[model samples]
Target: MGHYSLGVDIGGTFTDIVLLDVQSGDHFSHKELTTPDQPELGVLRGVRILLKRCAVQPQQVVRVVHATTLFTNALIERRGAVTGMITTEGFRDVLEIGRERRYDLYDNFLELIEPLVPRELRLEVAERTEPDGSISRPLDRDQLLAAGQKLKTLGVESIAVAFLHSYRNPEHETAAVQMLQAQLPGIAISSSAAVVAEIREYERFSTTVANAYVKPLADRYISSLEDSLRQEGITAPLFLMQSNGGLVHTKEAKRLPVQLLESGPAAGALVAAQFGRDVSETKILAFDMGGTTAKLSVIEDGEPLVAYTFEAARQKRFRTGSGLPIKISTIELIEIGAGGGSIAHVDHLGLLKVGPRSAGSQPGPACYQKGGEHPTVTDANLCLGYLNPDTFAGGTMKISEAAAKQALDTVAKTLDMDTASCVPGVTDVVNENMAAAARVHIAERGGDAREYSLLVTGGGGPLHGYSVAKKLRLRRMLCPPSAGVASALGLLIAPPKVTRVTTFSNRLSQIKIDALEHAYQELEASAVQTLKESGASSTALVTRRYADLRFVGQGFELVTELPAGPYGDSTPDRIRELFADEYKRVFAITPPVNDVEIVNVRIDVSGAADAKLGKQRDEAATESRVPVRRKAYCPDLAKTVDMPVHQRANLVAGATVAGPAIVEESVSTLIVGSHGSFELLENGIIAVELNTGDRA
Candidate 1:
């Protein structure tokens, strides 16, 4: 008897499910169209299909890990619950005022992001706390109750309480929350200190408000999903993927759903890092292109970069300050609206543009035959012969080539070109868009894209990775098996972790060692409690410490790992040396006179590490089946060519394929250009090497 783990990841267009046997290291996967009206319905359907396909019983499932983009979608679509905010008097407009910096300076029609909570719903109460954790003005209980009653009368479903200096002292906010919860019994309440206990007021309040806005929705969905699973005979413990690339208990997720804003993308990055480590490639560029968006992340030394702040629903995709900011630890990545279902059209200036809008699963690509008439990247790929209509999705789903052509023709007529000619332009535009976004993201982090190997995952990633890599002047790419569901698999491989952070600003030289020790001790206690709630034993817990340090006057801080210890006089000097080393590594120079300041401390406690999946076993070599040849458009040659198509499953280890070929897998396809070649590694990964001639 063996225990099994199920991983479910709900993306914008698809729900991916992976079921893995812990003892035998075997797995099964399935993908289904996401039900936007009820996302959990898709999850349940995928799970049922996958379990039946694998002939596994629901009782064998011991754990369930899930990641979803529902919260992110709700924020972008403004479909969340009616939410209100309560703050200290005179600070009710903090969310609207927001740093008072315009994202675009010269534009006369600049539109800043509107706060989630409107001005009328943002009530104020008389309460104040000093930065030093002292209560300057006692919380006005009567005023707080009146505000709560007003919100209740207005039919607000959720409330966020953010007072001035709440991060320093949560007493006032906590008191307000108690009163609100007592009066409005069914209403959801979120406090800034509990959601994101950081110093920045705008980010903290935004994060708390966002959490409250989504809490009722998440709570209902999770509860419904649990009940559905129970009815289906699954008694497993449920965990959720967090934006920080860790898994937390369902209880924790319901309390702070804002931390799951980028959960799906973070899982993809984790899987990319795992694959990079497996191949011994430390510098990796993780590129994941699914149906609705493309995500790119950089990994160094088998670790992805982590940031304490993230933005959502950006008005401008490439601009940093054009979105609502949330303060939560997350993997740093850049996401663009380049994906398989991205629509292509001619703009008002007659220039061709490929999406910031998508035809998601409901009416996906024209080839899907679900009544979509718009030309999309998938339609272009189909028209260009990059996709096989007969074998798409293992032939379970039919593709309409006529529909694809009709869709492409509409856009082609607008561009004044034949469909064949427009096919390459559409694909090239999307690939270039991704390449440009990757370049900007890497350059901003002081990295050179040419120095990294691209690890491609997701359905569209392997299809377009070669071209994207060529644009970036990269020569290597790796596509793992079952790439379409890699993110779901990542959930199975992730370790259960809990991270706790607190602001502890102090100059390094003048820091009180006793206070620092107490802070860490408290964080560790909290982390331990969280991990315990997630089912990790005390003996199996491993704690790591980090400190955010910067020059006294700097606006941003860099995190450095600190050694476990009871701090003494000598520990500060060691900490300084670590900071200097890190500074030199990042900036290539160490300042001489500026004193270092500690801004925040973080604690990460993780459970026992997950076992890695075993490599695919090799079978006895047999006579290779004759490759099928198809006439496909070659972007490099600017014409159609007779390209060979090989089934990925039939290609054994050490098998090689030349350029201008298509390697078709059950769920994805890899298109190798004329100047590129691919070799199947023993680990079931395709290593693609692109020559310089592959560039456009």
Candidate 2:
């Protein structure tokens, strides 16, 4: 009975549910329209449908891994629990004083994201910790009680505790948190040192407060989900996907929901990395375009980039400084942009613009025919004949081309053009938006966009990937099997991982190896203990060591992986050489002769990844094959053309299809332009190679 693993990814517009047979490594998936008001209902509905449809019993499900965007949406919409902040005296304004930098320096009117805890809720207590990690003054118990009382009186559901020099010595913060929990039973409390044991004051406090703000809401959702799963007779141990492309027990997720901010997208990136390695391509630009947003990530050397800090709830999507900063171990991704449900309209300046706003699942896109009259990218695709009316979502849902064109008339008429004439521009605008973002994102990472192959995932990704790749001047694109549910598939293969971070400031020459060794052992033990409590099992457990290093006087540092060591004498020079190589690669300049400083030390412990543990070739290899001919509007040729359409399931390994053509699947469709040829590889991916010297 314990032979299946289930994975669910709750996205903005769709809840993807996949059931994997552990004995056979075969998987089946279904997508359900998300219920925004009560997300758990939609997830439960999809779970039941997939299980019953696949004829799988609930008792067969032994493990469940879930990834969700609920907490991130809550943060962006400012709908989290009422939260308060407790800090040392004279640091009451840390949130407001946020590095004292403006995102848009020249704009006359600039608005920053308001702190999660209001000024009235940010109370300070008497405490002092010197820069040298000495506790000069003891904690004031009376003041702490008074602060807790004020928060309770104000109806604060959660509280964050932060004190000066907490990274070096968390005694005051820990004691205060323990007291608050004992005195104020049932109130959620978070300590800054526990959340992020680093040196930055504002960022640490912000990360802690963000954790507290989302605590109650996440706890409620997780509890509800677990209860619903139990009611459905699926009593598997449920795990949650973290933003770092790792799995953690539900208890850890509930305690620190902020770390799940980019959970779903991070899963997609992980799957992309695995897919790239499978194809022997180490560098990949993973493009995931869902209903509401498109995310891009760069993977090099078969691993996605890992960033130590992230910005959340940005005022502007592409602007770096216009958001709340949180410190954590997370997969690095480009800023999000337009996707399938992004609205299309003419601006005040008489130019068409795609969105930073979306028509979410409730109303969805116009072609869904559920009361949405505004034109969207989905509507444009339908008007262009890229989507079929009867086969949308494997015939579970239907779309109307007439309704799509009627909706497009809103913008077409405004531009004094027919819907056919106005349609290509909508797709072009969206594709260019994604391509521009990709180019800039790759350039900022010191890589060229043309150097990486595009790997497409999500419902919208395959439909738009060809155009985006052309605009980026990329030579190849790849579409995985079961593209629409890739993120959910990713969750099924995610290994349990835990990270431990601490500050250790010292120059390379003066480094105390014995002290560092002791700290590393403690951090490793902590991470191992947390992983043990999660109850995940995998072969070949692994530990990675990293340090944040920088030139002696630099304001920021680059995270560098350090060689595992039983350090005695040669460790300092090894670290120095690694730092110099990385520095020269990034800046194209030689490192200074002076010794550099190590700002932070981190350890990430993970089991051998599940995707590596086992893989079953897709079932498409055994299916009967058939190809049909259909006439669809070719955007590249600016005319309707007759092309052969093949069902992805019917195509066996090594089959080739030349464009212009369409490869249709149950959940997604691939639109290949006339400038490329697609080959169904042995691993079930349609690898597209563009014709050289031809621009689509």
Candidate 3:
């Protein structure tokens, strides 16, 4: 039987599935509305659709690599299983106490982020380990067994074990877990040492607890998916897309679902990187706007920037320390509530406001006629002539113009404006919100967004990308072919990877070089074994080393990469020089000589790049045919005008379309405005060049 590989990504609104022929790079894709109540339902449904479209039998499928936001949604909605935490006697309140810093100092009512685990549920045990891995007091077996018995009686869904300094010596935590397993046979257990293995007791414990909270759900879903696929006669080893822009075994992902929290958006960054390589630009801003949210990520040198820790499901939107912090490496990206499903309405002050709320896929936008009465971003686009009502979702779902008009009229009346004026106003407001978010995000990262090109993807991205880019003063925008499904396509190209971190505090000047080298070697060996267990071949193994370093007096540190070679074998002078350089890069200056400490060491293992990794560019290929032109309004120039309507399949590589045109594809449409033009690139990407002479 011919073999096929599938890449599936489940987003808030839609579940995307891409099936590819193993030898050939040819692929087929399907998009189905996600069943939020039962996300796996949509996944299975999308897979079936993909198989039928590709004319492949289930047994012919070789492997399936998937990414999903299910775990993230559970955390956001606070729907995950109830979880309990076990910590050293005095540290039971770490999750509750948090950093104890107020985000807004001036506010009369300072709202503290609620702890993931409540105080009553946090159980304590008598166990202690020093930073140097010396046992201060041995574990009290009776105390641990009683805690386990109490937890079992409490009906806790899962348990997190985070004793003092577990990162340095996990013996106590591991022993406690072993005892708990004997008492509580089916309870899900997680330890800070295995989850993050970093300093900062509060942060590490919180991260592990969060991981434990989602463990059962993630494991069940992944197991169900595997069983369903196996029953269908597909036997290929399953891989999963991770937040770090790489893939890993499904089994490994189930144990540490926190790493997969940002999986969907990370895929978009990968696809953006591929696009950047095509144009010879290493710096890019990946803009992925889908039905429920928009994601923005920075890419430099063909790699998506990574952050060691991230917060999820913030009670306060757009603020740090307001969510559950996960201590796992992930592609650093910003997500906002501006997307196709974002509702537009006039607030109490009569000012038109776009959303931090969405209609999502169930009710969707009013244009979808799915019982939604609110005027969403999609409705605004439809009313403003930016979308083809009848051709939405490739005509599988016909849109209702009447519903869109009615919804827009309600907002218009509330704002004391006509529908015609309200339509553009809504779209403009939403576009500005997105641009503002991008600006704040870029500024915080010490980068000017104007210097980078915007690579737009997702269903609504291409429609609003130009205006957003204009707001940021970016000259060019690129709407890759199948931009709406780019995240899923990115999954097809991701390589298998895994990361492990260990906290070992020491003065680089005083520590024995040989001892440090030995520790690093041990970490590397563990990483290699994990990769192999996850199906990576010996020849495919690749490793990268990093250190979390800072001045001895500093409370926090930045992650810096070590030069390729044997880790920790360098001289003290070399180590000091490297640290100083990185410190200067981050803080613009280095501290005077005192002492330097390396708090953590991280190792990442990535498999060899897939043979079918890159996209094919048939530069010699031409557009098949051109369709007739049509009249479409151009809001950029603030006028209704005639515009060319071209089928995406018929657009050749050299095909050029001036401003005021709609390039229609099965997944989404690209709107070239009055002052803009589009030309197909060497690949299938559509280069949208604005009047500034820069193509996006």
- List the candidate 1 regions with Cα displacement exceeding 4 Å: 615-624, 693-696
| lDDT value, candidate 3, whole model | 0.82
Per-residue lDDT for 35-99 in model 2, tens only? 98999899889888888887888998998899998988888999999999999999989999998
TM-score of each: 0.97, 0.97, 0.96
lDDT of 3 by residue, 1-696 (tens): 756788888887777777777677766667788888878788888787767765789888877888888889888888887898988999998887888877676777867777777887899988789888999899999999888888879899899999998888999988988888888988999878888888898789888988999999998999988888787777888888889988888768887888888999998999899888888877788999999999999889978889998888886788787777788889999998888889997778878898878998888889888899999988888876767766676555788878999999998898878888878888889889889988998888788888888899999889888888878878778988768788988888888888888887888877777766766778888777778887788786888878888888888888988765554456555767888888887678776866788888887888874636434321122354656566666857786777777777667688677877887777787877777788988777888877755434
Clashes of 3: 6
TM-score, model 1 to reference:
0.97
The residue pairs in collision within model 1 are none
Q: Could you tell me the lDDT of residue 341 within candidate 1?
A: 87
Q: For each candidate, what is the lDDT? A: 0.87, 0.87, 0.82
Pairs in clash, predicted candidate 3? 476-695, 476-696, 477-695, 477-696, 478-696, 623-652
